[model samples]
Target: MYKTKRTVFIFLILLISLIVLTACNKASSSSGDEETSKEDTKEASTEPVELTIAARAGSMADALTEVVKQYEEETGNKVNVNAMPYDNLKETVVLDVRNNSGAFDLVMIDDPWMPEFAEGELLTNLDSYFPDGLASDFVQKSAALGKVPYETGSTYAVPFIGNVQMFFYRNDLVEKYDIDAPQTWDDVLAFAETIKDEEQETFGYALRGQRGNPIVSNYLPLFWAYGGTVLDENMKPQVNTEAGVKAMEMYMKLKETGPKGVETFDSDQIATSLTQGQVAMTIAWPSWVSEVDNKENSNVVGKVNFSAVPSQESDAAAMIGNWLLGIPRTSQNTDAAAAFLEWVTSAETQKEMTILGAGAPTRVSVYEDPELVEQYRHFPAQLEALQNSVARPRTSKWSQVEDTWGMYLSQILAGQLDIQEGLDKANEELEGILAK
Candidate 1:
């Protein structure tokens, strides 16, 4: 009986030992599998992706190139940048999309072209990529411009440049005239008149009145401030209304104090005139802010200050012309492109980009960052203008409309057509164009 009891005890011990050994083996295998899986994921994420981007050429593009360099280093990715003139960007991207050629993984777009791209289904729905929706750091108007329906549609892009027309003037000039900063259209006109009369060497204003987009973009702020709109609520032509006539007259009056050959001044000429200290004041974009302060490019360094467009019967309103970044639907590496997009537009990245002289920050927080504010004094006013700015009419046909209206407006500016007659003719032509 003692021997049988001992045997039973040994048998039970052996069974327990076997169970322990199996459990150890299973745990070891599981741990090995987990480690291998993690390593695989790491390898996949670190795999090199060659991303291509289409961007506008200039300092803005230079800024992006710098950001791309930082991104490549951080992620071990390769990037190819294609920077072209602004005039060619739309056509190039559109061709790539229409042909379903995945030549570019990302494209920087002007806000006005969002409608056409969205309508054509050329861009991916970026809203789905961000599980919680876009970060709320962006200014409302600037953010809205990236949506397909302006305020309501799914987001197809993110605002890459915080662009709004800002009213810039020489602070020293204003102080010298003993005039408080112009707060209204009347104030702006008065300042311009005083400067033109007193400062013989300096033109009072510098505005872009060149044919086509240049003249139209510069004029629209004044048009809206005077309660003039290109179209009424029903989308009918209203450019010949009383408000339109008044806005045009005010614009011409302001232009009278500008340089000789004002009718030929485009954005480049306007920016040069302002930085050269040949003009006392101008309504301009933040893209020129750096040039205005650079000692090499500007004679008015440390003297220029920016404000919102001057108010009139209506409160001040700026024209928002933000550029956006988007992924094309034909892109094979949407994930990689999206990663770059999110990284570039983040508040932290934007602050860095601002320091690098890229486009203006699209984030309100970036604009408000203490260090950034110190470096860019106009940031506060720029944020204010961006928040209050209005978009051009949200029509797919705006390009055609602008071409037609701009031609007539240019004719009027050159004394080739009377203001009222020119406006009536433009209204008629725009109606026909929109109808088609």
Candidate 2:
């Protein structure tokens, strides 16, 4: 009986040992399976994604194409770029987003168009992706263009190209005439008159006066400098104020020293006149900086200088015309699009893009990069101007308002209407527009 009891006890011990061993093995296997599941999920999240980008045609499109090539090669992703004219690109994006079509993952926008897109709820609010908000390294004014409610609301885009209006002048002439760097509109006029009289081949100034957006753009700096406001506190049109008339009169005087058909001039004419040594002074976008020094294109290489627009009643307010990149709300690849935005706007990528002769950079670091500043001599001045830039009116009806204002301003420039008459008419039309 004692032998039987000892054998039974030993059997029970073996049984207990086997049960515990099985439970340990099962727990280990379960843990391993969970880890495998997590790994699979992570891999799926990072899998290669195909994306589509809609970009403005011209140099912007070319630069983006080259950058996309590098991105695809590095990340094993595919990107199809659809480059079109500005109007067509805007229309396409609006249609796609309005229809909820997952067509364009990314789109390039002019800064002025932000209000329209934001008000329509067409863009994705990027606040979540950028929880900490935009980095301080971005030009604050340029970054503000991406925010809704004109710099106080959630971000909808990122400033991709830093294009601000810069004052360009023939430094050689300024020195020749012993003129100081212009500090006010009055000084610019005096200096311009001197240059026009002294220089036989060159006009004193060049301006964009073509009817629609061009004329309004050329006039805003002067308008704001004279304490003119496009709209009052109640959103009423103030284009016919005393300040507006004075600014228009000043604009007319500047035109007197320009080319004979200055009333019909546009960006191309303005840039060409300056680069070919035909204009002594002008306000132009940063894109023209390269041509001013390029031997192949410029006749006044190393003779031009850039600065912030001159002040009058108010301080200098360079008109900001930055191009922005945004993810469409209908984009099926939001994560991939956001990734591309962060990558492109980075200092490294912007530096690369600058080397390719892309648009002006939006990052402070890129503008201050030693190599870039050396290549683009206007970089420091450009950075200064961007930091002090001002945006156009932030209203969904800005297009209509600008169109009407331009028409009247063009008529005034063409001598078809006096300053007061044109401004009054513009204000009347603008009031009608905002009412709608």
Candidate 3:
């Protein structure tokens, strides 16, 4: 009886030992599988990738091309850039993503088009990649353009070009007129009048008076300063308000101070006017800053000075027109694209871009770089303007609104429609557009 009881106890101990060994093996196997899976993922992510980017033509594309060259050299990746004009690029990007074609791994976007892309669910949710959120070194307003709800919401893109409207004037001319830098629209008007009357060789101001985007852009700073809004708190058009009419009146008055055929000037003409010393003052983009200082292109090199736009009832608010980089939802190479974006927007890369004369820097550090500030004297003012900037109304219908509003603004400039009639007509058309 004692031998049988001892046998049973040994048998039970053996069974328990086997169960413990099996559990240990299973746990070890599971851990090994997890580690191997992670290694595979890491290997895949590090493999060289071939990517395609749809980039806007001109300096933006040129800058990106240079950056891509550096990125390829460092990562052993290959990138093919298909650069096209703005409208064509936008159409291709939208169509490719909408159809799930996966033709572009990445694309450049104008800030205003972000809403359309976001609303259509066409961009990847970038929040996951940026686990800690965007770095604070990025200009808040410029970086805000990447968000769907303007300054708030999940980021879908990063600002690539820090293009903001800058008030450009010939410092020599302003000083010659014995006036302080024009701090208010009234001040600008008076300065324009003085330059127009006395400096017969130079117009008081140059206006981007062409219809559509050009005219609307030219008028916005004025409209906003006068407390006018494209859309009120309720998303209603208020372009014909008391302030709007006053702004328009001021806009027309400024036109009188410009030279003949002011109704047809666009960016090229505006830049030419300022660089050639034909205009004493104008609102221009940072893209023109190089031209203003290039001795080969500018007659007034070292003479033009930039500042924030003049204020009125409201504080000065330069319009933010940053170009953004976003990965498409249909992209097959999103990881690689995100990597490139992270690299490009870095302070170091942006500084290189600025040095290459590609585009304006979106980073505060890059803008404040002593070397860059020295080369581009407008850097300081540009930084200030970017910080104090305002984005256009965050509506997918902004293109339509700008179009209708531009048509009337052009007419108002040409005397084809009176100010009140033009504003009323534009406001009505904008209402109809928003309703849709």
**Ranking of all predicted structures according to TM-score, beginning with the best and ending with the worst:** 3, 2, 1
Q: Can you list the residue pairs that collide in candidate 3?
A: none
Instruction: Name the runs in model 3 displaced over 4 angstroms.
Output: 1-35
| Per-residue alpha-carbon lDDT of candidate 2 for residues 1-436, written as tens digits (9 for 90 to 100) | 9999999999999999999999999999999999999999899888999999999988888888889899999898888889999879988999999999889999999998998998889999999999999899999999999998778888999999999999999899888878788889999998878877877899988879999899999999999899888988788999999989989989989998888998889999998999999999999998888888889989999999999998899888889999999999999899989988999899888888888878599999999889888888899989988987889888889999999999999999999998898899999999999999
Candidate 1: residue 325 Cα off by (Å):
0.6
Clashing residue pairs in all predictions, respectively, total: 0, 0, 0
lDDT of 1 at 3: 100
Error of 3 at 187 (Å): 0.9
RMSD of each: 5.8, 4.0, 2.4
Candidate ordering by lDDT (highest first): 2, 3, 1
Which stretches of candidate 1 lie above 4 Å from their native place? 1-46
lDDT for each of the candidates?
Answer: 0.88, 0.91, 0.90
Residue 152 alpha-carbon offset, candidate 1, angstroms? 0.9
